[model samples]
Target: MHVFLPDGKQLDLQQGATALDAARAIGPRLAQDALAATANGDLVDLMTPLPDGARITLITKKNPGEAAAVFRHSLGHVMSQAVGEFYRAKGHPADAVKRGVGPSIENGWYQDFDLPEPLREEDLPEIERIMREILSRNLDFSRREVSKAEALAQFGGDPYKAELIRELPDDEPITFYTQGDYTDLCRGPHFPRTGALPGAFKLMSTSGAYWRGNEKNPILQRIYGVAFATQKELDEYLHRLEEAKKRDHRKLGRELELFVIDPLVGKGLPMWLPNGTILREELTRFLREQQFARGYQGVVTPNIGNLELYKTSGHYQNYSDSNFSPITVDDEQYMLKPMNCPHHVRIYASKPRSYRDLPVRLAEFGTVYRYEQSGELNGLTRVRGFTQDDAHLFCRPDQLKAEFLNVLDLTVLVLRTFGMNDVRFRVGTRDPENTKYVGAEDNWNAAERQIIEAVEEVGLPYSIEPGDAAFYGPKLDFVVRDVLGREWQLGTIQVDYNLPERFDISYVGEDGADHRPIMIHRAPFGSLERFVGILIEHYGGDFPLWLAPRQVAIIPIADRHNEYAYALEAELRAAGLRTEVDDSSNRMNAKVRAAELSKIPVMLIVGDKEQEGRQVSVRERTPEGHKERKGVAFDDLKAELLERYRTRA
Candidate 1:
């Protein structure tokens, strides 16, 4: 048999030869390091024999990042073995511990377990010791495919494993992995041996996780561990986690008085504080100005609509659970809008005609509500009620490409205005099996093709992701990474054909006939509330001069200088900067420290010398050592700040 490798070379092999065998045949050294193989572009255990004439690529330790998830998955089993051993050493029977499914997640792995006694964070060290011992033993991992009944018999007394087996599709084969005396149910592509756990693995923490991620299921203790092929990589990842923790939006939002999530107000409902409101209003103002400049017509729509409105848009069937329960007002059942599109569609349907009106762009800072689970809520990023800076463009089929290109230009401009340069875009397409999509195959293909061309024309790097599409459409999601390298999904441009077809929306064409319009739904700033929260952390609350909630704070060295501070504040405010006078009795050091802590972008000092000299000392919120003590002409500073604001920086 011959299989073409990812590099396009064909390799001749014996019948049923696996990728592992192919690697070994290629070179002796390659055989020694081969961790697993991607057979036909699917990651599979080395032990699994390949189908005849399959594409093969052996993943190894050197480029282990691709196989990291698989590696962490195997390490999970290694941890389970160590935990069982630890339990035995204490004279407790291993059977008392029950295991749940453990899967690999980004940067780490976690496994749930029902233990006789709850594990403590302090107990992790001893568990680590046993894990190290098993790693040093260097046991070879062995795998077996068993019959469904045989698999059930193997885990007969283990309900978690048995339930897992019972839940799998009847046609799916059951497989088990064994290393030393420990056996686990898994479909694995392990490190080939236990020694892969060498120095780079550690049990980080434990949390309560429900079985299969459902709150109604039994709660099990989930122990999380991060693994890498080398210690340096592990250290770097750990350090990054620490930095992310400090800048986590949930933590920073509270400390900065940006937003509040009150349990009494219901989960995922965030009330913007005064400062947070200021941020939201500024972002809205910026987006409205930018949208108007880009030829978008601002549209106003109610927050609730007749239930049939969503049914026509295909969201009721797909997203009804996420939307708030419908409100019954007399004879009509209205739903709190879960999306802005349904309303925009109604607007487009109100009255429309002609190819000249083809690319009508409607923009709005529309507030929508969704019932996100409490556990899933995280600050402003994931929330129940939020506003989307949304717009929908209705265009002719032939104009799709140009409309997409214009949107790309607008998206990049918006991102640059916010200083978000590390952007990643993923083009999301359909899941054919689901059968919920309303468009024809050709229309979906055309939308995807137009987006691909526009994305390419912009010369931006992107990836295509399947199964992430809207049921009515395909979309391009723009994600931005913050200072700590944590990526946040911020903007989106969706090509929707299903909605227009379902709504029977059409406009007059050049041929004097009605033609269906292709809808392009977009929001460069996905949500003003969420974007501001991310921006706070991305800029570490030290917003660029124009966007800062309080752009400049006036500081007085002593009580005698208070008058000048007030004068400076009034002058800056009148000149169009958000300015404040700090007339507190605290000393200069305390005042300056407070301003710095609050992340005020600029501080204007009005001491007796500066006041009498008719000048103000300016201190930027950059590092202290980078300070410049010179005063700018009052009018000059104001003009510069206004320019920055006008630019939406």
Candidate 2:
């Protein structure tokens, strides 16, 4: 048998050879660096035996695939060893602590442990000391392939390990990784020695997480740590973290008075303040006008809908776990809707349609609720209840591709309007092995084909992500990158083949036959709350000229100029701009500072000279200085503001 190497070299080998064996056959140097293998496109361990013919890509430290997973999984074991040693050194038994699953995730890894006592922030330093000492030991590593019974015996005294071992499939290898005296039940291929791992590990935070992410499960202390290939990488990541903290929308929101999340009102609900509400309303108005111009009709839907509506849309079937519990009315049940598609579908079905009316776009600012975990709740990014700038397009099969491009164009316009030009697209398709998705294979294939053509014909830069699609359809997600370089999932466009079939939605074709109308569910701003949060951080709470809640704030220097300030405010308001006047006897400089702190785009000052001349002094919000007075004609200033508002930039 032969296997094609990454460099297109063919290596003749036995009919059944493992990746590890293949690596050893190549060279000793390659064997030392080999971590795992990518058979075709799937990630698999080196221990797994290969078939007769295959395309094999060897994974090493340079490849962040199977190698990274093995490395991080081994690191979790190291962490557990450190904790156990720390407890033993304190004359405490290891069995007193409860251990949970430790998995390697993006960036680094985290492990959950139910400690005898709560771990303090100060304890991380000591824990790091122990971890470094173990790393310095340079322990030799080995893997053991054993039976389920043998694996259970190896970890029986350790309840968590035993539980994990019990869950392993009978066909699986049931392997273990061990370094020195420390061992863990893990699937491999990890580095040959502990010394191979880079010495740039740091414990970042300690938080409570449920065991296996179930709220009913025991609460465990989840210690998150980040590791890098070099000290420079670690330092740069730490700096990014600091920058992220500085750009935290929750902190900036409070400081800028943009929005508020009060605990008394419960978690995950954001109450937009006066200034923040202005921002929300402005965004809604902009989107509404855009939809109106794009052949869309805006409709209003209730905050909650009957549970049956969700059942018909398959939300009850696919997303029941994430949705809020039903609001039962006697024998009947109602659910706080988790999505806007159902209501929009009802609106589409409310009227008769034909192939001539191929596409009908229904838009709404739909608010929905989810059952987010309390611990996962943040100010606005991860909220239980939020508004979505949602729209659903019901169109004939022939019109699907064109309608998709239209939605894509609208989404691009929405993002570009606010200067959010740094964004990437993810084309989410179904997982081949996942049976939970709702569509028939033919319909799914047709919808996915049209979407791929639409996105590609428009020349979009995107990656096709398997298993990331909504249960009902293949979708495209618009991901925004903020100032801090954090990616935020904002808008989404889904081509749903399942919902239309499930709801039995149809239209009269030109052939005088009843046929299914393909549904395209889209939300330019996936969640208005999350979008606003990302936008705040992206701009550092300094909104664009059009989106600024307080477009202009007028300040009167003295009682004599108060009338002039009022007059200036009226002039601005009459020009269709939002304006406010600070008539209090506060210092003019102080008023200006307040306006700047609130991130107001413009400030109008009225003093003795301005009041007499009937001209208001204008100071724009610029980085260099605040008192950058560039007095212009009041009418001219109005025209510039109107231009910015109209352009939405």
Candidate 3:
């Protein structure tokens, strides 16, 4: 057999050789350090036999993508074994603890367990100690294949493992990994030895989860742990976790009076408070102005539509799981619109168009509904109903590229305005083998090619992601990283030819013949609710002057200064500023503290000197040092505030 390296070097090996054998043949030092191997871009265990002519990239600890997952998954297995040992030391049977599925997640790993006795938070430290003791032994991980009946006989008393084996197909290989008398059924790509795992790992927390995420199944205790290649990396990650806790949107939302999700109303349904509504309205106005300047016309659509409309759009067949159930009234079925494109399609078809009317851009801040599961609901980020800054462009084939570039320009501008300038693009295309998509092969290829060309022309950084496209078309998703190094998919622009064809929408061409138009669907701010949630966390509740709900707060030193403060507020409001006066009986310093806690961008203090000079003391909130400008003219202050709002500073 022959194997190829990443650099195109080939090696001849024995017929039954594995990645470990190849690594040893390359060099002793390489074999000692190698954690796993990627055969033809697929990560595999070192012990797994390699096929002829396979391209192999030996993964080390420096390779975080595959190596980190392998290390973390091995850590999970070690933790589970430690749990069993701890139970046996306490005079319980070794088999007293039953294990469920355990897998490596983004930065850590977790395992589910059905214990004979309840586990508490204090038990974590003991489990860690046992894991370290086991690591000191430096045990080797050995893999073996067995028949389904033999595997069932070994774990038959443990219902969870037995049930899993029973569900596997007869032809599929049944594999198990064993290390120092502890074994588990897994499809593993793990480190060669237990000592290969680093000591920079810790148990985070525990939570209750149903078996396989089904509500009717028994609840199991899930333990989570995070690991890294070095102690420095672990410390840095822990610091970031602390920062994230302080900036949690749900906590800040309540403290800032932004929005509320009440179970009394319904789960996953959020209603914006007055302060949050101001944020929503300001964002809408900003985008609306930009769209208007870009030749997009505003259009309105109903919240519900006939079921037949979605059937024509192919959304009913692909997205019915996420959509709310249909409503039947007098033998006519209607659905709460899950998306705006289908409704917009009907609008384009309502009247006759021509090449002169080609590239008709229709825009709306449309609200949509989806029946998200109860467990998946979070703060505003995941909701049952939300509004999208949606638009659709109907254009000729020749105009498709220009229209796409225009939308891309608008999306970048919107993101930069919100201080989310660190952006990347992903061109999501259809999976070649998936039958779930509804479109011709040529149409999919054309749409995907156009998206790639647009991104390339703009010279933006992007990657191609297969199986991430919508059923009808290919899309370019804008992923932005925030202040805390967290990524959010905030905007999207999709190209479609299937919807127009399904609805048979066409326009008259210059030759007086009907021609099908291509549709470009876009939402610069993917959803108002989710965008606001990200913004809240990104800014840490301290919004910029232009987007702040309350632009100015006026505090009176005493009752005597109330009149002047109210007069100042009136003048500021007249100058197109959002202003508020603190008329409560609290002291001057207390009012200042309250305004600071609320994250008001500007604070004005009124007193005797200000009354005599007809001026106010202004203090601006900034991330850096704070300074006060004493005795500034009220007119100048109003002008400055208005200018900032106008320029979106």
Candidate 4:
């Protein structure tokens, strides 16, 4: 067997040799340092056997993108072993601790176990100690494949493992990896030896999770752990975790009075508080202005539509699982709309005739509903009901690229307005092998090519992701990195031929014939709820002047100055600024502290001297504490704030 390296070097090795052997053949240091390998761009464990003429790139700690998953996954196995050992040491039989599936997730790994005793948060330390002890043994991880019958027999007592084996396809290999006394059913590319793992791993927490995420199944105690290739990286990640905790949207939402998820209202349903509603309104106003200027005609649609409407648009058949159950009123079935495009399509179909109206841009701040699982719901980010900044452009084929470019321009403007300037793009195309997509092959190819060309022309950085396209179309998603360097998918523009075909929507062409118009679905702010959540975390609850729920807080130094503070608040509000006056009996310092904690961008301190001068002392709340910019004329302050608000600074 032969394998090729990036440098075009080839090595002839024994048949069935793994990537580890290939690395060793290149250099002993490379073999020892290698964490994983990319075999033809597909990530593989160092233990994965290389095929003849395969291209392999050794993934060391330096390539954290690929190496992190391998490291974390191997750590999951170690944690599972440690958990089992901890239980056995506590007097439970070795086999009494039944292991469920354990897999690596983003930034970490988690393993589920059906144990004799429930795992507590306090047990993490002992589990970590056991993991370290196991690491010290330097035990080799040996892999083996077994038949279904053998695997079922081996794990018969563990119903979870037995069920998994029974469900697996006959052609799929049932594999397991063993390290000393610990063996687990897994198809893995693991570290050759226990010592190959870095010591920079920690058991984070534990929680109850159903086996295979099915509520009907037996609940298992799941332990989560995060690992990194180096201690510095681990420290940095932990620091970020701490920062994330401080910026968690749920916490900020409550403390800042942004939004609330009331179980009484329903799970996964969020109601925006006054402050959060201001955020939503301001964002909507900004985008609405942009869309209006770009020739988008705003439209209002109902929250529910006839079930037949979705069936005609293919949403009923394709997205039934995500949609709430149908409501039958007077023998007529209606559904809470999971999307706004179909309604917009109906509006387009209402009155449309000429080629001149080829690019009919219809926009809406439409709220949509989806049946999200309870466990999956988190604050406003993942909700059952949310509003989308949605728009659909029915354009002629020739106008598709230009319309897409315009939509992209609006999306970029919106992102930059919120200070999410670091952007990446992904052109999501249909998987050639996936039959789930509804469009014709040629249409899919054309839509994918159109998006790619537009992205290329705009000179935006992007990658192609196969199988990520919506069932109806190929889409381009804008992935933006916030201030904290975390990426969020904020906006999308999709091209669809399927929807037009399914709905039979058309416009009279220049040739005096009916022609199907390509539908371009776009959401500059994917969902107002999710976008606000991300924005809260990105800005650490300190929004920009234009978007700030309360732009200014006027604090009176004394009861005598309360009237003056109110006057200043009125002036600021009249100038289109969101302002509030602290008229409570609290001390000035306490008022300032409260304002700062509320993340008010500007604090105006009103006192006797300021009242006489018709000026206000300004204190700006920064990432650091408030910076005092002593007395400025009220007129001047208002002018500066108005300018900043106008420019969205």
Predicted candidate 3 versus true structure: per-residue lDDT over 1-649, tens digit per residue? 9899988999889997889999999999888888889898887878888989999989875664457888899899999999999888888898899999999998889999998887789999999999998888898988888999989998999888998999999989899998898999998977888988888899999899898888898999999999988889899989988988988999999999999999999998899999999999999999999999999999999999999998889888899899899999789999999999999988999999999998999999999999898878989999999999999999999999999999999999999999999999999999989988887899999999999999999899899999999999999999999998899998999999999999999999999999999999999999999999999999989999988998899998999999999999998888888899998999999999999999999999999999889899998898784669999998888888899899999
TM-score (all chains, Cα) for each model = 0.93, 0.86, 0.95, 0.94
Which lDDT values do the candidates have, in the order given?
0.83, 0.82, 0.92, 0.89
Between candidates 2 and 3, the TM-score winner: 3
> Predicted candidate 3: what Cα RMSD to the true structure?
2.1
**Which residue segments of model 1 deviate by more than 4 Å?**
1-20, 23-27, 166-173, 623-626, 631-636
Query: Which of 1 and 3 is the better model by TM-score?
Result: 3
Q: Which stretches of model 4 miss by more than 4 angstroms?
A: 27-36, 45-48, 59-66, 145-153, 166-174
Q: For residue 112, what is the lDDT in candidate 4?
A: 89
Q: How accurate is candidate 1 locally (lDDT)?
A: 0.83
Candidate 4 has which clashing residue pairs, if any?
none
Candidate No. with top TM-score: 3
Per-residue error at 331 for model 4, in Å? 3.8
Clashes of 1: 1
